[model samples]
Structures are given as structure tokens and as C-alpha cells.
Target: MKNILVLCTGNSCRSQMAHGFLNQQLGDQAAIYSAGIETHGLNPGAVATMQRAGLDITSHTSNHVDEYAGIDWDFIITVCDHAYENCPFIPAPNAQRLHHNFYDPSKFEGSEKDTRAAFDKARDEIKAYVTDFASTHF
Candidate 1:
């Protein structure tokens, strides 16, 4: 099975969401992992957002990219620009590098309704991207 890595600035939001979507879409075709340049713990908003979409990411943890240094990655996808630009060089020689700058819902400061909407928007965008990625790649 192929190994895919989803990366973000902090493993709290976008990368975690993409991990959930990719796992749902790819199934046994690929092994999906998510990490960050720095760990910020799992975001509660992210878990709740994914729950509404029928995907469970509550068991997921915030991991640093170094944790998987020994594995060979088939693809390394960055879900945010900060990660894409600041990520250290991962020694995945054969891995295809992909990037998308998803908005940070965590940065949204507003009412509860607006905050949820922000997370929902980010989740939908990530879902669409990962769905197409699964179809095209796997």
C-alpha cells in the first residue's frame, strides 16, 4: 500500500481534516498520516467539524514530521502555506510533493455561529481536495 503524508503548520486543523477525508476515500489503497512542523495538539473545533461530516478524527494526535522519518512516503502534501514554506527537508526521495494553502479556521475570531461556519468551510474545501486526490492518484 502507498503511504501518504499530510502536513500543516500545526497538526491541529487542516492536515487533520485532510487525513480524515483521505482515509475515508482511500481506504486500503493507501495509508494516510498527518503531521506538522510543530505540534499544537488536536483542535476541538476540528474534531467537532469532522464529526458533523461523519468522519471521526478524535483518535488522531498532533505529531511532528520527524516522528515518521524512517518511513518511505509516496506523497507529501502540505495543507497550508506556512508548512509548505517552513517545513524541513524530509528525506522522501521518491515522494511527490503537493501543496494547497487552506485557510486557518482557528484564526477566525467571531461568534460561535461564524466560527463553526469557518471550520465547515475549511472542512468542505479539504474534503473536495482529498476526494479528487484519491480518485486521481489511487
Candidate 2:
């Protein structure tokens, strides 16, 4: 199976959402993994946002990019600017690198409803991107 990695500043929101959508879209066509330059644990907002769309991401974990080590990656997607700028060399010699600066709902300070709105927006954008990614790549 093709190996794909989705990365973000923290393995909490954007990358996690992307991971779930991609997994659903690609199914057995690829192996999807997500990690952060620095692990921030899974975001509850992200999980709840996705659950609303029928994808459960609660079982996903926050992981440092270093955990992937030397696996040959087919695609390396950075979902935030921080990760794109700070992540070190990925050992996949021919991996396709992609970047998308998705909004960080975790960085927002707001009431519960407002926070959920932010997460929902990010999740929608990520879903669109992943749907497109699956059609174009797979």
C-alpha cells in the first residue's frame, strides 16, 4: 500500500482531521498516517467536529514526526505553516510534498459554540482537500 503522512504543528487538529478523511476516502488503496513536529495530543474539538460528519477520530493519537523514522513516504502533506517551516528532512527520497495552511481552532479563544464553529470550518476545508486528493492521486 502507498504510505502517506499528514503533518501539522501539533498532531491535534488539522492533520488529525485530514488523516480521518483520507483514510475514509482511500480505504485500502493507501496507508494513512499523521504526526506533528511536536505532539499536542488529539484535539477534542477536532474529534467532535469530525464525528458530526460521521467519521470517528477519537482513537487517533498525537505523535511526533520522528516516530515515522525511515519509512518511504508516497506523500508528505503539511497541514499547517508551522510544520511546513519547521519539520526536518523526511527520508522518503521521492515523496510528494504538499502543504495546506488550515485554520487552527485550538488557537482560538472563544465560547464553546464559537470554538466548535471554528473546528467545523477547518474540518470542512480538510474534507474538501482530502476528497480532491483521493480523486487526483488515487
Best by lDDT: 1
Candidate with best TM-score: 1
- Candidate 1, residue 15: CA error in Å? 0.3
Deviation in Å, model 1, residue 1 alpha carbon: 0.3
- Candidate 1: residue 124 lDDT (0-100): 99
lDDT of 1 by residue, 1-138 (tens): 999999999899999999999989988999999999999999999999999999999999999999998899999999999999999999989999999999999999999999999999999999999988988887
What are the models' TM-scores?
A: 0.99, 0.97
Candidate 1 overall Cα lDDT vs. reference? Answer: 0.95
lDDT of each: 0.95, 0.93
Question: Pairs clashing in candidate 2?
Answer: none
Error of 1 at 88 (Å): 0.6
**Candidate 2 positional error at 56, Å:** 0.8
